[model samples]
Target chain A: MKARIEADLPFYFGPGRELFGFYHPAPAASGAAVLLCPPLGAEQIRCHRLYRQLAHALAEAGFPVLRFDYYGTGDSAGHGRDVDWTRCLADVATAATELRARSGAQRILAFGTRLGANAALDATDAALAGVVAWDAIADGAALVGELDRMQDALKVDLNRFDQARPELDVRLEWQGFETTEHLRAQLSVVGLPALGPRTAWLVSKGSDAVSEHADRQGRSVEAIDVAPRWDDIDRLEMAILSHPLIDAARRRLREMA
Target chain B: MHEQAFRFGSSRHLVGIVGLPPVIDHGVGVVLLNAGMVYRIGPFRLHVDLARRLNALGYPTLRFDQSTIGDSGAGGKLLARPEQVVADVGEAMDLLHQQTGCRRFVLFGLCSGAQNAHSVAHADPRVVGALFLDGYGHRTLGQRLRHYLPRLMKASVWKQWITRKRAASGPRPPEPAFVVEPLPGKVVGGQLADMLARGLKLDFVYSGGVSRYFNHVRQFRECFGRLADHAGVSVSYFQESDHTYVLRGDRKRLLDHVAQWMGRHFPVTRPG
Candidate 1:
């Protein structure tokens, strides 16, 4: 039985900008509420279907889940040209706020993919009972480098475009988002554990070195190599909805509250 | 986000299994990369056990078969090539990203797996860090010729050719070495320098079993400079630990050091 999806959700946390999201409200009393923050760029695209499925699955299991896009990506708002540091994180807090207000659930769980996971982990003031990252990009620089590596393989160099760098070291905005030296420095020191206290961490490794940081960080990190579907787009959306972990996460969120 | 099967790239099949501690969704993930081949962990269970223990400690882990081996997709040739392994790692990372919305990433592996983790972190600053390298070496063939010249020079050229072919292939590409002494031998100094230049500050602990390759710690000293420069990196050698910490022994110290070091560097948000 399909209830309804609360589309075009709006809320503000940090900068008070009207951020956007899509909410799935279940028919029965919810077990827990989950707010899913998608990774930047293509991960959002690749995991789109998965997140939707996760929302639906959680709803089926008595937990309400909401999946939404960040400031500059997807159909949310703002031109699709954001690369800023602060705005994205603010969006996370906003999403959490929206989930809490709309779902009216006691505890909130933030589930993110890749950069989205990093964003969730970076959030502090938000009242999230538990946080899970499908596979998180702990280092924003690494995600940039992974993309850079792909570009280099394809013979492209974006760093070279920063010619005025020597003249203008001021915070340069790539896309509509500006990255400040301060933000870069803050991000550099960031690890998953920085997400404040009483946080639940999940690092998905298909049994590989990707789990190294999880092992060291001592956060309850696990490697789940489930069938990875979805292409460059809608990957997280689809997995979060249909995957098996949603049930466990829903249970944890309920217990934490 | 438990034990799930997946195919990475076109050739390598990957599995993110529950470790000993079963970190569940919020755990450390380890991606095992075989030197010349991508092997499965379901049957062997060494990597599986490692993943389980880490899982028990709230660390999630994964190990996948590289391209052209096991039941994975087809990943061209040069299976264990640096770039190739990196690509497989990228795929696994993507999978991990899909399964867990983790912000921080760490790597722990052995042999080429360890080397791959180091290189990924070195090139990509985003890597929280890495821990591995049961066998560390630093030497080129030409440099070795000088040291072994007096003896190797006396050997026949035909014998040299055969030895070269065998040595070129990584020892125990698919399995751990049973015997510790009769090591497959390792290159020293120059060669190690060239390969490790790409690694970031990957903090790790090496067991004495890998001592067979290190004639002098100084030979590989240069590699540490770049690592030292990285933001969060540390490394040490556990003179007594083996490749895989034996379950019955006091192996927890090394891994615990890793866990503690992780606690000191990347603090996790404990359930408050």
Candidate 2:
């Protein structure tokens, strides 16, 4: 029998910044801790319920989990104007350190979805035992292009009637959330060469960019195909737990353990 | 405005953010309830923006997650009953009252949140006013004809009808699921009458998202009987905006309207 304890606390990740997070402690230590990195904008709101469920499930499986919002997002301190890749990368590293210190787990696994997976890949260091990147973006330019297409699909043109368009330095709007030009530049050229020995690249159906990139690098990667439910614009509020996806990720982690 | 995160409830499991202005001796404060499964932040973080604006207006607000939702832990159970939600809200009011000495409160909620706020207002005497966005509204016979008659006279409707008739020979894809659950009209009407009789201020707003059931401005009275005509009750419909004010302009309009309504009904005054 496993009893999980959950706490909502703030992580002093940086100077004058506090990131909000929920820590789910397992009944017994599996010597491994997981940090959940959420995606940005509407995707974060839509997948929040699923993330909580995943945290609970992982805790039950003996992996202490910590799920959090990036700085300037969710319940965290700071404004939208401050969101950038540098800050996001630092936040991830800080969250992992906090989890390691709190859970006393010798091994650490970072799980990220979408842009979060991109951040996870960038934040991965020697201490990270393994990584589970779900629906990751391998190329930053492609990610920005996809976001542009998604915005067009949603019929959102923030500057449609503006006779005078602002410069590229101005922030861009993504599905009602603000993104700075600095963040856009960083995301335009992101690349994930290949994962280390213990890495899983979960790609959506009809797209294997990450897997192909890994293969091109002459590296072995666990490429698992899943539906792109995270990008679903319609059912963003519906908490549809994909058992197959969860089971696949779980199997990979179990093998690592 | 000063904002702080705190927890209060049985076993201190409910987590909430209390927004207080520089002055804390206000008599009437505000409490924002959660909308369905959406957390205390409300959809698109609307509640946060609303609370900040209200605090600037010198009215303290407390927005919290119901047990089993958001940052709050489950109250020793997986599912929370309706009564439990009301109790949690009452506890929030109690906490705010103890903190600010506020005796009167105005409840704000949207969608399922509107239902919860209405329920709390009905049960708690401290709730002086309630603002409901995209709340429960029903259609009347006249409204039904008014809605369909225009389409009946449309050339596109007839053309679509003929096209569908021609395509009826082929297999039809199952109609996609569309869930619509409107609250009971009679019960809401009775409650409205009672609240109005006690001098309770009511602001009920419906956006274009709920136009399927409530389209016309006069539909409230027709649907819920004459009780909707009470001077204490105000009904408004934003036909162009959706259920959640996704557009920035629409949200500004809503906030302005709410600020004006709050000023008129539950004005925050300096303590003597």
Candidate 3:
């Protein structure tokens, strides 16, 4: 077994170079590049390690990979409140371009999890060769509802010993990240867009709706039981380092190539 | 503000971002440590927000991940997690010193990061100050009374107690996979005394998340006794904020408080 080389080059690109990303240049280029679109907020934090691992795996398998934080999140410029769904889509496109330019790979494949998957599907990029949607969100309203439930549950857990404080009349926010009214409206209307022929749907075992939706769209779906529960409060701090998911993504991208 | 990404360390695998101001005003830069497993951005991007704010105040800031965390790889030399963290942080200071000519530094952290900050500040003579959010605290008699008395007066508490007693006979909830043990009061007090004697400025902020062990402002005085009253020590207790400061308002309050504290104690000398 050879010791894997990690992504050594970290750079800023996109408009005003506001976006931060790590480029994992493949020792042997496969003529295809992988752009990892990360999930939003807390989900992004949970998946950070998994994404890094996936990037490494993809790079070793001969594809250059670029993983980045969308604007208003992570090391990128802007605050959490500035996060917009449309902006996320644009960032995905921008990152895909950056990855193509850096790797000199004509074919670009996007691998995104959760909301990131949705962004990849919706992004209008000419260079996108394929997409791997891992547990992609099919319904935006459902995600909002789930996040709201998690927020309420978190309050109950934090205030277990004391009486709950009066709810503050403030803008929509979940966990620590704030969502603008525009983004909330955008999320509420999110539904599965038409899947491309090269799209790969990797969903959790219990997510029958996503699989059925893909099947209805004449798209095949791979159900993996090892997918991390992104919204589980108990394992909020735990990183999603599921090897099965990482391997499945790598294999899926290789098949696409 | 200028932000630059860096990959430095012995193996040149450690990753960090340095936030620089247009004009350098202070000789002491700020270095942020990772809070638990979360990356260099810190929980809710707190480190990024803090670094930018500190830069606006004319102080350079570096937030980096420890080895095996975030983008950072394992060190070339094999060492335990504790020693690796200390070494990683020292290298961060060294990087800032080399890049920006910062002779002294202030360390800031939250939760586990706070523990690391305490460790590094104690070991490194170049650390001029350390700020800890929801850091170490032991339950003193005052804290225990403050935590329980309000609940004892509430009727809902007794009802919940009765409900829990009935439920306790049914089934036990699964034990947590991990538990955080609080540091001993005696040891923390002694460490604080030593740091104070060395003229290290210390700031402690307790949030509602740690209310079980630290509830009121005076709990600091009761927990650490004489050391809490030292001129070099300052404490703030925000009973409304959770451990991670999840709420946007809570996070803003935290950032503002931190900036003000830095301005007061570690005031940046303006360039002529």
Question: Which is the better candidate, 1 or 2, if ranked by TM-score?
Answer: 2
Taking the tens digit of each residue's C-alpha lDDT, what string does model 2 give over B173-215? 4534423354578887788778888889999998766766777
Q: Which candidate number would show the highest lDDT if scored against the true structure?
A: 3
1 against 3, candidate with superior TM-score? 3
Model 2 lDDT per residue over A165-232, tens place: 22222236555466777888988987774544366777667456776876776645554553335454
Model 3, B30-137: lDDT tens digits are 999988778998887788888998888888999999887798888889887668878999999999988788989999989889988988888888998999987888
Tens digits of per-residue lDDT, candidate 3, A1-257, equal 12344445887889898999999889889989999999998888888998988988898899999999999998998888889888888898899889888999999998988898888888876358888988888778988888888777766553432335547634477766788788888999887776553688898866777898878878898876543477776556657778888888999999999
- Superposed model 2: Cα runs more than 4 Å off: A1-14, A105-107, A124-129, A155-171, A180-182, A193-198, A217-228, A254-257, B1-3, B6-8, B11-13, B71-80, B98-101, B150-183, B225-229, B270-272
lDDT of 1 at A238: 21
- Going through the candidates in order, what is the number of backbone clashes in each? 108, 1, 0
The candidate that achieves the highest DockQ relative to the unseen native structure: 3
Error of 3 at B157 (Å): 3.7
Candidate 3 structure lDDT: 0.83
